[model samples]
Target: MLEPSIDALQEKINSKYTLVTLSAMRARQMSETKNPLVDHPFSHKYVGMALEEILAEKLTIADGQKKDSE
Candidate 1:
């Protein structure tokens, strides 16, 4: 089972494409910066950490195109 289930993530991002894109972009940023929004990320992999951030509501899409997070 996916740790942060798809259903749970869907609540944060309505579109799957947006979700994937956001996750991928965030993951790349995380890999390069080695910094995560969540104090304690559930997964070591950047992608998983990104998903966790989404589930925790620490990350969000603002005004459709903007991305915001702690």
Candidate 2:
């Protein structure tokens, strides 16, 4: 079973598409930088670390309009 359940993650991210996008992007950043937001030992994968960061509310999505404007 996934440590941070999908349902819990969905609550943090409004849609499945957004969740996937955010996790993948964050995971890639982590992989490049070799950084883990959470001090978790369970996951050695960047995707897992990203999800854990999301669950812990350490990562958040900015409003789409704002992001697009930037």
Q: Which candidate ranks first by TM-score, i.e. highest? A: 1
TM-score of each: 0.85, 0.82
Q: What is the lDDT of residue 11 in candidate 1?
A: 77
Error of 1 at 59 (Å): 1.3
Question: Residue 59 in candidate 2 has what lDDT?
Answer: 85
Q: How does each model score on lDDT?
A: 0.86, 0.81
- Report the error of model 1 at residue 69, Å: 20
Compared to the true structure, candidate 2 yields what TM-score? 0.82
What's model 1's lDDT at 50? 94
Q: How close is candidate 1 to the true structure, as a TM-score?
A: 0.85
lDDT of model 2 at residue 1? 90
- Candidate 1, poorest ten consecutive residues by summed lDDT: 61-70
